[model samples]
Target chain A: MSYEDEINQDILNSKKLPEKLEISVLRYFWQSNPLIGKKTDSIPRFLRKIDVLSNFSENELRILAKYLHLRKFQPGEVIFKQGELGVGFYLLYNGYADIIVENTEGTDEVKPSSKHILTLEKSDYFGELALLQEISIRNASAVSRQGCELLGLFKPDLEELINHYPVIAAKLLQSISLIVANRLFSLTREVQELKYKLSSYEKDQDASN
Target chain B: MPQISINTKRERFKLIFFISTLLLAFIGLAAMPRVSIPLLLGYVIFLIVYPAVPTLEKLGINRVGSIWIVFSALIFFSIYPFVKVVPTVTAEIENVQYFLPKIEKYVTKKYEELRIEVREKTSFEIGDKYFFQALDWIRKTSTNILLNIPKILASLLEWIFFIPLIIFFLLKDGKKFKRGILKLTPNSIFERFYFLSHQFNKKLGDYIFAKFVEASIVGITITSGLLILNVRFALLFGLIAAITNIIPYVGPVIGFIPGLLFSLAEYGPGTTLGAVIMLFVVANAIDIAIVFPILVSKVVDLHPLTVVVSVILGSQWLGMVGMIISIPFAAALKLIAQEVYKEIYQE
Candidate 1:
């Protein structure tokens, strides 16, 4: 047989029905195997739902997941205290966490009052500033509302990622920057609206006078 | 409220359990010197070479491939030296015994001459009691060390087999190991503990790397200079210089002493002695001037007094290894202290 004809013959032989069926069946079995495959697949699956990390590909997310630390917190447990140095950015992997801001002003130093800022649910992330800042201080404390699991990525992990996987690190940084930028944009808009309201209120008082 | 209390109690129990587990593991490791020593040695080597793996990975090789490359390169370089240098170093160490008696005799003769001069000058007898005792101590220690060479080499041969295995596994699975420990850390102290350990490890790695380079420079300079000067036992003296140079302020002087005495004994207090003295001075001057400022000081950042005190304490506790590790340990302590100070006073 000629070289091209020989190659065609080999391709035809390999494409026989039994070989294709066997390969597909083996792949299906491998994917469906709960003990070996599905356990490690959960983290990447969880990460896939995160809006900020949406930029990461499946492989990238898998690599990123290896760097994360899964921490379990008891109910009412303090994740971090206000004004404490923080080096970890954490994602709420499961359950809820409360962000609490303590009232720093006032003489009630011994029994300071705290205000609830927000309750973060699963897929929510906080502490991005910790990863970016040179000296990150917790402005508000994070406490587990009714027990939770957190996936934490610390400064050291980020540094390792940057060293070993610069592409993933850059994408992560970009996502964090996007989050910060969105928050800043909204904050500035709120400030502008408040300013306009204040000016109108002043005009109304002047007109009344 | 009752539930909260129960949760806190559980947390406290977990924290204590975690701490005790760590302590137990440390005690276990410390109890076995044969394993722990090589493990420690491998850890140090791992720290020194770990950065290269990441750098190689950045150049586009896969992690395992990079690890293998770095590992093979390390093995090749180390084995080349081991094969070539061991016999020469052993011979030199053996020859050093004969040279030590000559140095001792020279010292004794000088002391005698000094004693007579003092007696003549002041019409008072000079006691040779303490002087003779010191000479005796030196002679005994030198002989003991000469006898222990074989034992040291035997342990070294074991370490040769053990350390690379430890290093290879460490290089491969170090991240997984760190993660495993982090998983055990209590939630309350996790961030602080991780940060502290990370900083300490980085400081230690940097300090060791700096010290290694500094010692190599000093050792090579002295050895090559002595060889050029036709000094006997050049390699042995060079090795002594390198090893002693790991200690802080007193190290350079201690390293120079044997060479000084040897030259004085062999060549008298003349040109060769001057040349040897000059060689030590220049080598140390290079260290203090160029290497210390450039490499070591930046990594350690400890005050001279702190270095000296730590070295003293370390030598008291763990002898030579303690002295070698003291500066970095002190630096880590300073970091922890600073963190505590910030916590208490700043906020």
Candidate 2:
């Protein structure tokens, strides 16, 4: 079995804690990382180990850490499906995920397997498009390539954070915008190059005619 | 990007679906006040316990352990009043009932004397109805409260048992529960939701906490003062003061009269009344001096007229309890208004 398969098995084998302890564990993870809470290391140290959350201050990150829910996903599990409604954002913590776009013309939507567009590793953030739009749909499906631990920020969580600590929310918005702007700029360049190539090709065709 | 709400048809459809789901939930709630009451109580308890979770965690306790600690402390505090003050309040009610006829006679005599004096001076006999209307209202309110005492106790008992447990689960699964509710908001409205909810939470929580502290301080002060004066049912009178003090604008006046009457019953108008007045003055001073500073942010800015109207409406609807809740309710309404209007008309 692959390492991914092994991690998936480990997650399954993980002992279920008592309800009270489980709640504490969930709350602790959601509120603040236990590892970072002990003053053993600064949040930036841990954040640097992950991608995306780079722009936020240690103070802002501390507030964010307190509320972000760390979620687990198994290998072969679909995190979300293409064309499905989306309501939350995900920041990958560990393992890998396949960003897949379904072949809508032929295959079944419910089937696990799809065309993989890219592999997202640790620190890679996805599902942000869902956050930007009022009603969001997954353009590409996200499926775990291995057992993964993820930091999940649902819309409500962001809203609550925004409500209490708007400055931090502003910082988070800026981060997301940076990513979106980069993507938009790159896409604009690609489209410009494609348009130039197409026009040149058309001129050649005209000459042949 | 900030103003970008559900721009696409699909997003709008999602928002519509979510709103419809909310409408259905509201309908379900309206059909069941019994369930809704407990649910609302649970939500309120959760809100109170929510900030305390971090404190407990900071103290090196796990969430469950923290919740256990908070609940235990709450129970310990709550049981003191239940065991000590509740019986006193009940016994005082019986005493007040016994004194009702005598009190009525004394009031009637005074009313007739005032009416006679007004008739002689103005030569247009002002009806005793106008004079005694206030007394009648007070008498009716006290009797109503007395009659409903059992029901109030029953509800309080229910809350004591259920609220702690509800608070426990709420703190445990609060984020998850909130997420479930938030899932209903389409991204378009989520920002608006975020802004309004934050303002609402901060203002309302601060207001409630400040009021609670004010009440406790007032209760203790009045109770202590009355004890020093050797006044009867000092705890009961103090509790009354604290409760009425929660109602804005006219609360202190309402609270003062009962203490005056208690003093009147004990030592006539000479000694105890003077002591009572002095006690109130000192208590008000402390409130203005200390509590105001602590509650500067918590102060629910409302027009005096708004307060009076709300108080009257609240009294009409829910008696004294209604009156107490009405001021805060009006304040909350103001917050909602500010949120909606500000968002709607943003430059």
Grade the docking of candidate 2.
incorrect
* Distance from true location, Cα of B113 in model 1, Å: 2.3
TM-score attained by model 1 = 0.90
The deviation in Å at residue A45 for candidate 1 is 1.2
- Candidate 1 residue lDDT tens string, A86-144: 99999999999889888666475556678788899999999989999999989988888
Clashes (backbone N, CA, C under 3 Å), per candidate, total 0, 3
CA deviation > 4 Å runs, candidate 1 = A1-37, A108-111, B1-6, B29-31
Residues A1-209, candidate 2, lDDT per residue (tens digit)? 95446556766899453344345655656678545455323434556665456777777787787666565555555566676557668888789877877656564755544576888898888888777787787798777775676676767667666756767788888888888888899999999999999999999999999
* Residue B299 displacement (Å), model 2: 5.3
Q: Per-candidate interface C-alpha RMSD?
A: 3.7, 12.8
Alpha-carbon TM-score of each model against the true structure: 0.90, 0.62
Minimum summed lDDT over a 10-residue window in model 1 chain B is located at B1-10
